[model samples]
Structures are given as structure tokens and as C-alpha cells.
Target: MKRFAGMLLVAVGVAGCVSNPGVVKTGPSTYMVSRQGKTGFAGIAGLRAKAMGDANTFCAQQGKQAQMTNTSQSSGMPILGNFPRADIEFTCVAMGAE
Candidate 1:
């Protein structure tokens, strides 16, 4: 029972560390997508991809294509394991009227 409880606690902690990537409107025509994870260069790239993918998906749902304008990353608190993060900014480009 003690072992099971410890495992459960570990799982919960890991779950909390999982990044939930998503998009948010930052301007009338621009949107921002972001994600955070514990990784180095590859992880940062993956997060950037995830952010861009989310932006593309968001624009697609609005009958448009993502026109990525900029990309960024931040090395989060090193004391907290350097949780790297990535963000992408984009505007929705028209794909013709639906």
C-alpha cells in the first residue's frame, strides 16, 4: 500500500509537469501559442513546433492559414530545472471564403 501511494504521488507530480500547449489572441489579428517543458535544444524545438501547430490549427478552424510572424523562447527558472518554453506569434491569412 505504501509503495502504491508513493507511485501515485510520483505520477501526479509528473502529470503536473506536463505542458498544455494552446493558442491565445494577443491582438485583433494576431495570436500567440505557447508551451513549456523540461528539455534542451530538442525539447525547445518540439515546444516551438507544438506552438506553431496549435496556431495553424486555430487559423484553419477559422478558414485561414497561419502566417507566422515571429517565434520566441525563454529559459525558465534554472532552479526549477530550467523549464524551457516556446512561443509563436501569427496572423490568420485568408484561405478564401468558406
Candidate 2:
């Protein structure tokens, strides 16, 4: 029983050293805007809100805009977030209006 527990610990450690194995690429692509927001106001009794997706597109359709950011890969993977494309996220934020 002790030997089995030791083997389990070793396996868990090895798994941690392995890279993420579930990220999928949609082919040469960009970051699809996952969400959107807006703010405004009218009279004290008025209200403001944001609409998702392009109004020219549709209300039922989800909102999304693709901004090409991912540009490289390492170890046969697109190192997105803290790994490869961290800058892309920052750049994307800069593109948005404050």
C-alpha cells in the first residue's frame, strides 16, 4: 500500500511537468471577442446599457470580433497567456476604448 502511494505521488509530479494538453487551435486565427460592454446615462430616471455583437449582425447572434494576436508557437504549441502570447492580451486591451 505504501509503495502504491509513492508511485501515485511520482505520477502526479510527472503530470505537473507536462504542458497543457487540451488547447485547440481553430487554424490561423485571431482572438474572437468573447464579450462586450458599454455604459451611458440619460435623465435621473433614464438608463444606459451595452448591446452584444454587432447590431448590424443580429440580436440573437452572439457578439464576437477577431483581433489577430497569436503569432508564434513553441514546442508545437501556441504559448498563449503567460506562456507565449501574453503580450497579445495586453495589446488587445489597449485597442479597446477606455
Candidate 3:
């Protein structure tokens, strides 16, 4: 029983550490990134920061800049199994291009 309990704890820890999926191309030059809070204390601000960082990295990789189009976040009740989350929509544009 102790071993089983330990295993379960480990599993839960791993699940909480799960990372956000990478950015997705939604349309021409437009992309989206999303992140879920890892724990009850994790706030939407943290999730949004992570997502924005990812978007910037992705655009940089393409030799472009990230121009945010829209952003949304939900501060769900983590106690009820609804964790905070954030989604960011952006477009990859040239350094000087609108």
C-alpha cells in the first residue's frame, strides 16, 4: 500500500509539471499559443507570460517579430479542477512591416 501511494504521488507530480504545447499556425502568418497553470496557485499572468515567451521565440526563429493580435485568459477555480489558462494570438511580421 505504501508503494502504491508513493507511485500515485509521483504520477500526480508529473502531471502537474506537464508543459504547454508549442505554438500552432492558425492562419497565414498568424499563430496561437496556449498554457495551463500547473497548480492551484499558478495564476493566469504566469500562463500568459509563458505563452507570450513561446510566441516570441517562435517568431524569432522565423526571423520575424511577434505582433500580438489578441489575448485571453481564464482564472478558473483550481479546487474544482479548473486551472488557470491563457491563450495568445499573434502574427509574425517583419521587423519594420505592419
Instruction: Choose the strongest candidate by lDDT.
Output: 3
lDDT, residue 9, candidate 1: 77
Instruction: Report the error of model 1 at residue 4, Å.
Output: 21
- What TM-score goes with each of the models? 0.69, 0.21, 0.75
Which 10-residue window of candidate 1 scores lowest in summed lDDT?
Answer: 75-84
Query: Per-residue CA lDDT of candidate 1, range 1-97, in tens?
Result: 9998997776567546767547888989988888877433347788788888888889899889998899988855533335677889899988863
Tens digits of per-residue lDDT for model 3, 1-98: 99989977875776567567889989977899999876667778878888999998998998998989999987546654356789999998888788
- Candidate lDDT scores, in order, read 0.76, 0.27, 0.82
Cα lDDT tens digits, model 2, 7-62, are 77765565445442222333443222121111111121111111112221331233
Q: What is the lDDT of residue 77 in candidate 1?
A: 51
Instruction: Give the C-alpha lDDT of model 3.
Output: 0.82
Task: Tell me how far the alpha carbon of residue 27 in candidate 2 is from the true structure, in angstroms, after superposition.
Answer: 18
Q: Which parts of model 3 are misplaced by more than 4 Å?
A: 1-19
Where does candidate 2 stray beyond 4 Å? 20-98
TM-score of 2: 0.21
